[model samples]
Target: MAWRYRVGLVVAAVALLGAGAAQAYDVAPHRAVYRMALAKAASGSGIATAEGAMALEWGESCEGWTVEQRYRLKLGYTQGGESDVAVSFATYEAKDGSSYRFFIERARPGSMPENISGKAVRGPAGVRAEFEAPEPVKLDLPKDVLFPTQHSLAILGAAEAGQKFLSGMVFDGNEVEEATEITAVIGKQIPAPTEGEELLRRPSWPVRLAFFGPDNAPGGLPDYEMGIRLYDNGIVTEMKLDYGDFVVDATLDKLEKLPKPGC
Candidate 1:
């Protein structure tokens, strides 16, 4: 259950940062960047693979940019058939550098609230994201649940040492590298995710993410891998997740260039 909660939160953040409304043209100068990462693990017992892509877009509207993300996974167990799962189709707004609002549209089967709209506010000490359900449902996130969400922003926002962005959290970058590698680069613009359009655009900084095997212990989970390609303005062009027995793939099928939001 805790793993499910963490995965759900990670998926929500990813969807908002990678797939939501903020694209390269819509973001402000020097405010935000884009990143994509893949993760894979394969074991004799089962194979698990995941692909995550994110966009960091700044907003003059809310003072801080929004994050859009999209992710997919394919898992196969030695004794069971393969299963494909997608998590959190949503956008998140972080305003004034500390508060967050999430607009979630989709989730894996039976893994989310009926209608998902929520708010989270972070202080100098900690951050908490809350959801509003029609009826009260017991929701408890694992201790490590905030790592990806908070640390992702801290890394993007350029937080420094001795500063408490997520407060009381110490992220071992080396540990992160053990499981995933975040690579930043510049790339040519590609078509946006549109229905039936062909146009080329370039972004300022593009990033890719690759996840490796579980090095935490021997005889761990299998080796799985995924890759996401993103633009500086926060548009994802391609996503891939592959394990020996399962795979999920998505490409920028279409894109639409809209008028830049008035600052």
Candidate 2:
């Protein structure tokens, strides 16, 4: 998986659940930690083992929402090789969903380190982005494009309304030139898990999100997919990351409620 995009998108789903929910969705500011391990591997997948950890903090501000995430993974191959990947991501989205700022740093074996930072705003014309690192560039996006936080709310909104499928374009600042098309499949709501934090006790749904790249053909396979037990208040109890050849499971290990903004 492209860890940069993977980590960024993961945060997009988990951190922004505060804006949408069933029956007057309440905002939740919290911190979470998850332990990741390989759940399965396809034949000849070349993946022998995988283990990782992810830490995320979601907080509310007077004017916007803030999220910080750190992720690390170590992969062992059948052929006796290993790869260690680490990524740190942060973003802020205006409460009104009109502006966003992001920064990401990633390191992986055999690849140049990546550093990305940018700010984007929505205007009558469309979404505009101005990058500040790895070469500055200005770009315009589709008028209908949604930022990460907005996209998450849209998904939760659909779930609350009993909709099963929704698709749209989203810009998470992982790419510089264009936004991605995401198709979400919302499963029927189920009772919350019997364990974990109180936040996890709320009703949630099984959501599968498929991300398609701009270069992908219409109706083609997605670049990657994520399965999450998404709570109404924007908490994820668990996650499954599917990369076609292998699947990784992320189990929530720690969750803590955060104080709401005084404003």
Candidate 3:
């Protein structure tokens, strides 16, 4: 359920920023591949061992920024057989964070594939999300909220300012209901990432986020937590996904810079 953390990160990492914006990190278009493995599983979770791979490509189009993400996880069970979980998602987010359109699908063993498609626009009141696939429903966004890319940039800015704790509301269209309550703790800035490739070794910070729903939150335990080794340019070199019952670690295996449109 907290897997929305990963989904939001993918959306946040796949966007364009117009020039001359005051931001702590410059956004870029790139592709990243990660090797993933289950780090831990609580008892009775029915998980024996799991391995997966993820690939995400963020590129700019004439109309907006485009994102493509694919993930596959093979899980061997303690009781019996094995199952593969697959998810594919793509979206377009406007440079100004005023709107977003997304398409997502999830498939698993012995189950019908689930699909969601929608668009959202920000107005004076707040964001209004409209869903077309699965069903038609409208969801309300909170006030003073940030979209995916804006949320990422805000976190980076706070980290750069040496602020250790930050809180905000973020809407990534990962959920069909409401926005997520985000609380982040930023660690000291590191001059280099020891295990990262050349392009990833730049100044960065360690960030962790606890995500929750709006109701009874801050008092309620987070549904999930995510830790990231985030570079100044919105690239995450390493990540830990904590799903309450289980945890998974992701390592960036390949990184490639994509060509940007000439100014």
Question: Per-prediction TM-score, please?
Answer: 0.44, 0.91, 0.87
Q: Candidate 2, clashing residue pairs?
A: 17-234
TM-score of 2: 0.91
Number of backbone collisions per candidate = 34, 1, 0
Tell me which of candidates 2 and 3 scores higher on TM-score: 2
Across 1-263, the per-residue lDDT of candidate 1 in tens digits comes to: 00221122221111123223233233322222223232434344254433333333323342444444344444445566654445343434443335555544434555753345555555555545455533222232323323233334433332112221222231111111212322222234343444432223543223333232234244444244334454434334555544444444555543544334454
Model 2, span 1-263: residue lDDT tens: 44323755563532232233212457588899999999999888898999999999988887787889999999999989888989998999887667889998888878898998899988889889889887898889877788886777777778888889988888877766588888889999997678966777788899998888788798788988899888878888789998889999998899999998786
Task: Write candidate 3's Cα lDDT for 179-248 as tens digits.
Answer: 7778888899998657746677678888888877666344878878888988877788788888877888
As for lDDT, the candidate ahead, 1 or 2, is 2
User: If both were scored by lDDT, which would come out higher, candidate 2 or candidate 3?
Assistant: 2
- Candidate whose lDDT is highest: 2
RMSD of each: 10.0, 3.1, 3.3
TM-score for candidate 1, please give it.
Answer: 0.44
Least accurate stretch of 10 residues (summed lDDT) in model 2? 14-23
The alpha-carbon deviation from the true structure for residue 134 of candidate 1, after best TM-score superposition, in angstroms, is: 8.7
Model 3 alpha-carbon miss at residue 122, Å: 0.8
